[model samples]
Target: MSRFLFISCLCTLLLACQHSPKKNYFYLSPISEKTVTQTSSNVSSQLIGIGPVDIAEYLTSSQIIDNQSDNTLTMSDNAYWAEPLDKSIARVVSLNLTQLNNGRSFVNFPWRSDSKPHYSLRLHVDTLSRTGKNANINATWELIDNDAKKSILRRNFLRSIPAESGAKGLAYAYSQLLAELSKEMDEALNQNP
Candidate 1:
């Protein structure tokens, strides 16, 4: 009994010492400053959705240490959150909309306008979680029609990255998320023509 307790205590101390906290920070970077280009199918006037939304912001929480694990991100630097992921998603969506057509853009939500749009696109995002096991991020994306006020498309993006604490994981996960989101958006929007 004594031997078992001593071994466990020693192991605990060793782990606590080995796992040093890092100065980590992450931000989702824009793919590029240039506007995304799409060939306009409709020549007529269109007023599209732009956003400063009332939707809930992105949320994040951390899990306590489970065991000693080292991954590429952590081995390189300390972990920390930077420039919330939710905001990045919003920006990406806005950018993509701008690229979709020669339509005017506005940041106001509830999607009302003096000039009516041919179609209105609104996105509601839920569950951008990063889990400790394999550092996976799971997100559900919904595209709604402002005129109809109902969902036209709902899709989930799930990605797994190496488990690294802090900003590294966030950045890696976000990049993956953006790629997935953009791809899906392109397909949906382009499907019209």
Candidate 2:
């Protein structure tokens, strides 16, 4: 009878494991596919050094965070970023910025030792809030001239976009927000850089 009970429990556990849903993984993709044509007259492809991006402490995790209520935040263990979230943002932002520039040189931060960037861009993400079907990113970015020690431009950009409802949709919203930021940065670079 003990043997029979053990077999039944083992079968139950195996069946339960088998019936569990598979975990889903997601990644953020660049907004630009291959190349961004130089259509905007002010666009310059000068090498821009972007890096050391700072993310909010709460958002610095693999799990996608969702604010279910004013005091409740939900994190999905099953839905995770394929890579670190901060690194992914850098890649996506680079893709967007490259298109805005007329030059072909865009470099991520911690660049080659000998490389000299035209402008150094830094970003601090204040909030990447996904409250409901809508998502938004509130970030502040600054640009500095490589040759000069003075600050070139600083601004806060906030954009809201539609999110699908899951990880995939959230990624879509983030991509859109990055594209908006790219456009703004392009304008800043063109103004006097």
Residue 108 of model 1, lDDT score: 32
Candidate 1 structure quality by residue, lDDT tens digits, 59-176:
4322222222342122224444454444555666666455554343535344445655545444454444444645444556555566677667767666665644554555655565
Can you tell me which runs of candidate 1 are displaced by over 4 Å? 1-25, 33-47, 50-84, 96-120, 132-135, 161-166
Error of model 1, residue 90, in angstroms = 0.3
Model 2 TM-score, 2 decimals: 0.82
Query: Candidate 1 — worst ten consecutive residues by lDDT sum?
Result: 64-73
For candidate 2, list the clashing residue pairs, or say none. Answer: 44-102, 45-102, 45-103
Q: TM-score of model 1 relative to the true fold? A: 0.53
| The best candidate in terms of lDDT | 2
TM-scores for every candidate against the unseen true structure: 0.53, 0.82
